[model samples]
Target: MDLTPESNQDDEAVGDLSFDPKGALDAGDGAVLTRLARAVEAVDPVPDDLVERSLFAITLAGLEADLMEAVYLDTPLAGVRGAAAAARADDTAPAEAKTITFTHDSLTVMISLSPAAGGRVRIDGWAAPAAGLDVELHRPGVDVVTVASDEDGRFAFDSVERGRASLVVRRTDGGGGAVSTPVIEL
Candidate 1:
């Protein structure tokens, strides 16, 4: 029971000789890990498409609850053939209708935006694999307008103010997750 430094020394000498488990990474260990990461990155760099998809997925994760994931497929404006000058001229011309598509696991939503009277845009939308769902149009600082899809899975929002907007499709029965499209400019 006489606890002395010499006794403690003797106990430790005969006790487990294993070294203390490493806790935090030391500078050299961290350097080695950094080198390893660099080597891996060099050997197989991340794909550009994969990174884009990952960011898209992250955005979907932050979306409203009960909303299904939808990926932006394409916009007609993206395919317009013109240089900067031509594009500027085109912008000055009468605004023509443009189509955009968003895809979900179960359905595809397509919408055409056309300029209407009173400086508003008309949104006509269709959903493939048709279902009687309600489509809601969302715009910042504006009241949400909702319309039920016809038997043909077609819906329309008239007199939508020009600006950024998005869409959400939900089953009338509220049985499944709602589908949301990315915000787009009209």
Candidate 2:
């Protein structure tokens, strides 16, 4: 027996076999969901700026960007050799400098933060397995400052402000993609 519907009578009879389109849609409370979504949107629509920012973030995430996570290691202050003397010098003096280390599969970066003249911070960095590379320093509210590593894989950025900052290291020839460290407080 061919069960396939061929005539109008067969099609109309098929409709009696437990086929309820509205009930199917309501089985999972889908109608309630649709109503809730519409009500919420009418009550408070999403902000345009937030939508723009979300789109921008999604676009950036879609880019082929490799991000390296820099781990913070506990180390002594970079420029403070005489911790006791420096502590005794002035009670109102600025905080001691910091040393940060970032390790990746290909390279390891170590940097020392010290106070420079004119109330600015100086960054001294070294790359291990030593090859000259490009180093970038990013500070909040300031243009990104960049420097090139010497033959010894050493780089420095002087007169940088004291605040949140981060670093990126890349090949001098721009061959490999850049790697970035986590943001740190200066």
Candidate 3:
């Protein structure tokens, strides 16, 4: 089933039957221990050597932490910070990670980047007002600076380093603010 926002409400109707443990037994063993044994046997286990090789690859490729985090989220994982974040977003609308915004009392920013030859990069930024505004580019370890926007409220980075970078947009009006997009790899 598609795990869209609309379908999540249907989870309520399935009820506790979804967590039944007896259903795990592959065979109809009358005894609990036999059922458990049969269930364990029915599952195929990953070999120790294969597991070690996979772990090596994950660590070598920098995927070990991300994989572990995914596994943690799939289980009954919890901590004070995670619990608090979940509680606050229960009724809040989910925001797109790729986009940010800034308004009179708020700000929004969206980013898309592309790579080019000769250690160059291109960045695309959008803002609400297509009026007097300034955009800036911040490369790793570089001093913060501002950029100019075209008439259409768009700015571009002709050629930037192929490393971490950030974009910020400001307005000429007194009420304008800036937004720093997440670190993007060029």
On TM-score, the leading prediction is 1
lDDT of all predictions, in order shown? Answer: 0.67, 0.66, 0.47
Task: List residue ranges in candidate 1 displaced over 4 A.
Answer: 1-92
Could you give candidate 2's per-residue lDDT for residues 77-145 as a string of tens digits? 532223323533453587466676788788888888777776567889999878879887765557767
- Residue 120 of candidate 3: its Cα lDDT? 49
**Model 3, which residues run further than 4 Å from truth?**
1-107
lDDT of 1 by residue, 1-186 (tens): 685655455554644533322346667777889999999999998743345434543454454634444443443345411222233345555766767677777778888777677767788988987889899877666777889999889999888776556687887877668878765556
What is candidate 3's CA lDDT for residue 20? 39
25-143 per-residue lDDT for model 3 (tens digits): 53343476776777886796543234443443333332111111111222255432233234334524341122223233344444444444453445566654475667666554666
Instruction: Give candidate 2 regions above 4 Å deviation.
Output: 1-65, 75-91
Candidates 1 and 2, the one with greater lDDT: 1
Return the lDDT, model 3, position 162: 49
| TM-score of each model, in listed order | 0.56, 0.54, 0.40
